[model samples]
Target: MKHLASNLYYLRTRNGYTQEELANHLFLTHQTISNHETGKTEPDFSIIQKYADFYHISAEDLLLNDLSKKEKNSRIIFDSVIFDKRDKVFIIISGTKGTYSYKNIKKCEILNEKARYKGKEEPFTHQVVTGVDWLVQANILEQPFYVGLRLTMKDGTHLAIYTSKQPTRTQTDFHIRDVKEAEKIKELIDKIIMKYKNDESYKMDNVNSKNIFFDKDRQTFQILSGSKGIYPMKDVCKCQIVFEDAKYYGKTKPFSHRLLISSFESFFVTLRDTYVGLEIELKNKEKLYVYVSNIKQKHHSDAFKADVKVAETLKKYFKTIITGNKTMKDE
Candidate 1:
């Protein structure tokens, strides 16, 4: 409030906007802009919010905060907007035939959480918590300029956070108006990530001596069992983890899913799953199914399955990186 006039003039000039241009952008007359800058008048709270949003700063900071201090951080709250939790996030993937799609989260789940947090945290955060389960339970392992997360359900269903590079397209948006605040938020996030990592249940991943680890440098998913090759994640169409009576494969077994890579026409195994099946549509429009069961073929060839993790990772990487279909795809 103390620097309202000064801040307005400074920000206008700093952004290379004339008083007339700024007024036009704000749908106001130049005289009004001049009046505000000259301290003859003040903008209403709504107009103040618009100015803050245009400048990518917080309204609170724009009104009452001093920004000239030589502080250690300059992080600014860019934006924060309310989102309706009851609404469903729709995914539309079109093929030559039509489309394959599903809601990102079930409505019942959102309603339950919404009711649970009626007077508590933001309703939208509940969806984030459900998808990125670690957010509420873990400490930050790392924070980057841009981050993406994949949340896989028990039945191979999954969701991706910010699958597209565009921030406007993402589900959640929040900004801190100061660098020090950003650092503090990062510290808090790191603590949450660490909490999840420390959880005993977090250790149950399908990794072992025989498991093929995803190689970041090579951009491939490869585990050497009887094979000596790496597989790129992009080409995978689908994957599955099969199951049989008492014997389970790929960590817990029946809960797993299989993967099919479009470019990898030949059948191969990159990791150890109970049963691995690749479904490919031939150029002739014929469907081919290749099944691999464990290190040995004896158990049940048709029963190759994929776990939620493997299926989710492969499918997500395929859709986001390879297919380039985050929102909608036209065949």
Candidate 2:
């Protein structure tokens, strides 16, 4: 802690604040600020932590490094914060949202909405794995400068990490202290997302080649069969996966088939003929329908039907994604 007193003096003076002002910000008496800067009194661990947090640098770095040197304190935010993981490229930037690898991640986007870190006032929030791909950058412009990035995992656990500390929830949005740095981070993340998201290796295989994929976390349905299309999960007012194996038209008969879907358990569905469609009703009252016409199954009579109960877990997962109201039975 040899450099602690000098560092404290430099930080306060560098910010152009009087001892009393710094004291007020830290909720301490002016004498404590003076004593610490003068090296008359040393702060304990808890007080040291407060100082490190206020300055937005790691406590260890503040303690060991000579921050008063121009190059020492002039750290590039990304260089100091980001570290590579494994043989893969550097993807996740550790912050309030915790470090996460891009591959395991479902999406990341800018969220301009200002709110308390769903956890604490500090910037560090959830997540700590690191990997790549897919980003949904949202620039919410309620005001001039309250921007944040909403990073979500595949499992639906999400968090919005803003650049600097914001006021408590009751007030309107305001500019965060390090907004410019935050924006650069956002752009950097977006670039990484674009690079890996389209790579053939990162995406999951299509659903039976129907060109449709369901994002369980986002609760949204996408159809990439022809052109790209997206629909929010809540917009899905109707859904059914029907099985159709046989159809008799006046003079012809269709054979029966078994459809097998691998999940937590393997099971088969036998249907003479079935139709599966997902319907969406948009805010503009427009209707969109996506039908699964790719499944073709025919099987012998000896094939056994799957246990319908096995679908319950998946059912609940999807239900949590869509289903707006409390409904008849609560999940």
Candidate 3:
């Protein structure tokens, strides 16, 4: 046992392997390697052979030889195997093939296959860490392109990795092993990015009122009670946008259309199904719901509808704010 333990540590360090790298090489966990090196656990005979093979030596030689003699003279090898894995920031990005780490990535760039840009031309670029918003893996209907995963920044910058192509199939390859894994990776990355957004303190000019707007103009369309005031887009948080049936089961209430902001209580937006809206939660736990009205439509007789111009104006403002502040905090 002592011989095996000592040899494990000696061989690992002699090969210049971190616990993680060693685990990857042996198809084992880091904790497993740590345990073996510390003499806290033992590997089966099969695992012994695997490690022996990885080191390009016979199992008998590995178990019998006194490795200390070689350890004294052996030089550590810091080869590309360990460095290659370390260099990547993401093991997978939004359900894609390659691992992308933030290590040396200067910026995220967008690519359009259908665009008639000049040869070898790419679209906009955003800083890899701070400028990226959350990782997105969604399917858009009737679109010529299939974006496997997208990184949308707070400022509306986007970087998308294309999904696998199935010429006969109309949809993107959502079932690929790597694509599925990338979806899970996207969730993890988003949670991490959201953590940074939540950590930072962003103050709103006023939290007393929840106003809904449509276009870029700062117009107040609909205002809810108990709000501090209308907060700018940067102060918004993740919110649930719910669209209810106007006449579900049978007749419905006047304000059947609703938008729920989790961060704010007693505050929501009443909108027609076609209305545009924005919901945000700030670091301080305040929530806002903004509804941009449809110019062509009107609210039910009993319900109130925001002004058409106001709706369009607020909509534009929210879109800009959401895009500009997609992921405000640094990665």
What is candidate 1's lDDT per residue for 4-64, written digit by digit as tens? 7777886675444678878888898999989988889999999999888766556887778
The CA lDDT at 84 in model 2 is 25
lDDT of 3 by residue, 131-213 (tens): 12212212222223222445554555444454333211122343343345435535545654543344223322222133432
**Model 2 lDDT at residue 246:** 30
- Which regions of candidate 3 are displaced past 4 Å? 71-331
* Stretches of model 2 off by over 4 angstroms after superposition: 1-76, 79-97, 113-146, 166-177, 201-331
Ranking by lDDT: 2, 3, 1
lDDT, residue 315, model 3: 42
- Cα miss at 28, model 2 (Å)? 33
Better of 1 and 2 by TM-score: 2
After superposition, which runs of candidate 1 have C-alpha atoms over 4 Å from their true positions?
A: 68-331
Compare the candidates by TM-score and give the number of the best one.
2
For each predicted model, how many residue pairs clash, with residues at least 3 apart or on different chains?
43, 23, 36
Better of 2 and 3 by lDDT: 2
lDDT (CA) per prediction: 0.39, 0.47, 0.43
